[model samples]
Target: MPKMKTKSSAKKRFKITATGKIKAAAAGKRHGMIKRSNKFLRDARGTMVLSEPDAKIVKKFLPNGL
Candidate 1:
């Protein structure tokens, strides 16, 4: 059988943590930041764990992880 290929885009955007959870960057920091508040920007900093339902979909692309 041929080797299963992983989704390249998903690999770059999503990360698998030591605890087996999907960690990703927070949204809303891409554009139009000129009008955004300092608090919003500050709080958005750093990574966050994806929700359970969403993580399930991402797991499909990382078949060899287990």
Candidate 2:
């Protein structure tokens, strides 16, 4: 059988933590930061775990993650 391929985009946007959780960058901080509040920008400065349902789907794209 052929080797399963990893989704390039998912690989770029998601990371598998040491504990096996899907860690992703928070959204809304990608552009136009000057207009956003300081609090909002500060809050988006970290990674977030995907919900159980969403994680299930994401794991398919990252079998090694699960």
Candidate 1 clashing pairs, residues 3+ apart or interchain:
none
Model 2 stretches with alpha carbons more than 4 Å out = none
Q: Which stretches of candidate 1 lie over 4 Å from their true place?
A: none
Please, what's the RMSD in Å of model 2? 1.5
Best by TM-score: 1
lDDT of 1 by residue, 1-66 (tens): 988789998888899988899999989999999999999999889999999999998999986554
lDDT of 2 by residue, 1-66 (tens): 887889999999999888887898998987899999999988888899988788888889975965
| Candidate 1 weakest ten by summed lDDT | 57-66
Name the top lDDT candidate: 1
Model 2: lDDT to the true structure: 0.86
TM-score (C-alpha, index-matched) for candidate 2? 0.82
Report backbone clashes per prediction.
0, 0
